[model samples]
Target: MNKVQSDFLSLLENHRSIRHFLDKKIPDFDIRRIITAAQSVSTSSNGQAFSIINVTDQEMKKKLANYAGSQKQVEDCSNFLVFCADLFRLEQISQRLNVEMKKVLDSTEMFLIATIDATLVAQNTVVAAESLGYGIVYTGGIRNNPEKVSELLNLPYRTFPVFGICIGYPDPNRIPEKKPRLPLGAVFYQNEYPNFDEVYPYINKYDETMKEYYRNRSESKREDTWSKTITDKRKIPRRMNMKSFLEEQGYPLK
Candidate 1:
């Protein structure tokens, strides 16, 4: 295989979210370089409609730890960052350039672009951290209390926390295992989506494999198969009022 292909496969094969961290600190220069790598990602329209808040305060980290399902990584990690979908910068630029902020921020296209930019940068940060032998975890639970996070961060209108990330040296005692993924054929298709006839059998096999994996890995605490887990999750109502939350954050979703 080509070097690029080999490296990609290695990264994919070994990927896991690290929740346990050593108590050592990462150097500030290394932190800057990691964020620089994240900033190198291709941005939508070169607008770069995203920002990251570097959070290092112990008290704030403890609060965020509580907010993020009591995930220990939040308080134990060397660094925490919140990636934001931001139109606030664009608004400032429009004001400085004597253009209308309304012309840019009042579009569904702009909102989509901002969200994509934030997600892309966050992924890049994770990859960069992994390459540097650092453990990292994404905290989607930041959105669980979006208003509270916004208030804590003093975020202005037109900017919202997309997610948080924790980074640190990996703790040897709690090394995570690679989680299984669905077979490539089950997800990727030639052009149109593959029919159920071609996909269902693979899913069934995968479900059985996953059940065994969960029983072994999680000590049977989670007995349900992947399909059952998804079904159960969907049966319960999620914090589905995100549109109202966005509106509160001044994103009208126009």
Candidate 2:
């Protein structure tokens, strides 16, 4: 591979979700450039049904930090960008052109389109920001109180806050060690999905690797297996109100 390709892969491999940030500010030009890079990502059918809210105000950040389950990173980061799945823009455009879009906009397909579009753009933004020497973390906790977040940001109909990205200079002293991922074999399948029996070995191997990773990490060191950790985290029914919340937000997802 060429030097450029190798360097890019290295960057991706070295990524760590930075929660501790320095008290610094990102310049307007860099923010714009990051968005530009993010926008270059492909969207669903060119609908581009998403929007980003860059929150920099101190008071607003505090409220957002609370809404995001008291995640201090939401307030500490120089820029907390809320990536929204937005059909509101399309709705407005269709209305201006005397076209009907309400029925289609409320479809499950359109909801998927908007959600996928926002997620694609957010991933690109992460890559771009990291390339520029900034640290970043995705704050999915924003969805814990999606209604409050939408209200605070003044989000309109047919738009919902999907997730957020915290971008800023990393606190060098507190930067967490990179965590290991599942074995590729456990995730990748060829023509057909592999049988559970075949995948179990891969999972077992990964569990051992992760157990070591957890025990040796710089902070929050613990003795735990991947399966136990995942079960403990996911077995709980969290965010059960998201369906009703989305319906109220004009995404009935019919």
Candidate 3:
């Protein structure tokens, strides 16, 4: 590979979710640099329908941590960014121009667009932060009590917290080994989707790889295959109120 390709791939392959952070604060300039890099990423229809709330206040972070299933990383990181899929700004623009957007805003497609936009921006933010030598972990636990989190952050209508990212300097002693990923053959395809019989081999191979991974992990070591782990996780329904919550938040998704 060329130097640029090799360097970028190296950065991506080295990623591991860091839940432990040092007490040092990230510089303001570095924060701005990370956000700027994130903003430069592509947005759907050039709408840029997303907002990021950077929480640094200790008290606020503490409350957020509790709301996010007591994820201490939210409170301990130098910065906790809540990425919101936003349509409120679009509503404002419509009001200013004397146009109607209520119907459009209620469409499921629009909701998907905003959510995808926010996710894209957040991924870019991760890349930027990691490039600057910062450790980061994404917290989907924020969705456990999205309403409470929204209240704490004072979020307006037509917006929802998709997830939060905890970014800060890593505590070297706390870093863990990177988890294994499924084989590319299982996930990648040519044109048509492959038969299950063909895919099962790849899945079985990955299951063994993950079984080993969990067996040797430093903390919370467990003996489990990836398939079993995922089945156990998904068999139980979670966040069943999300649809109702989204409707209440002005994303009726009609």
Q: RMSD, each candidate, Å? A: 1.7, 0.7, 0.8
**Displacement of the residue 94 alpha carbon in candidate 1, Å:** 0.3
Write down the worst ten-residue block by lDDT for model 1: 215-224
lDDT on C-alpha atoms for all candidate structures: 0.87, 0.95, 0.96
Model 1 TM-score (2 dp): 0.94
Model 2 error, position 46 (Å): 1.1
Q: After aligning candidate 1 to the native by TM-score, how far in Å is the CA of 161 from where it should be?
A: 0.4
TM-score of each: 0.94, 0.99, 0.98
Residues 222-245, candidate 3: write the lDDT tens digits.
999999999999999999999999
Worst 10-residue lDDT window, candidate 2: 175-184
| lDDT tens digits by residue: candidate 2, 1-254 | 99999999999999999999999999989999999988999997898999999999989999999998999999999999999999999999999999988889999999999999999999999999999999999999999999999999999989999999999999999988888888889999989998899999999999999999999988888999999999999999999999999999999989
183-246, model 1: which lDDT tens digit per residue?
Answer: 8878988989877899987888789878877777832346767888779878987668778999
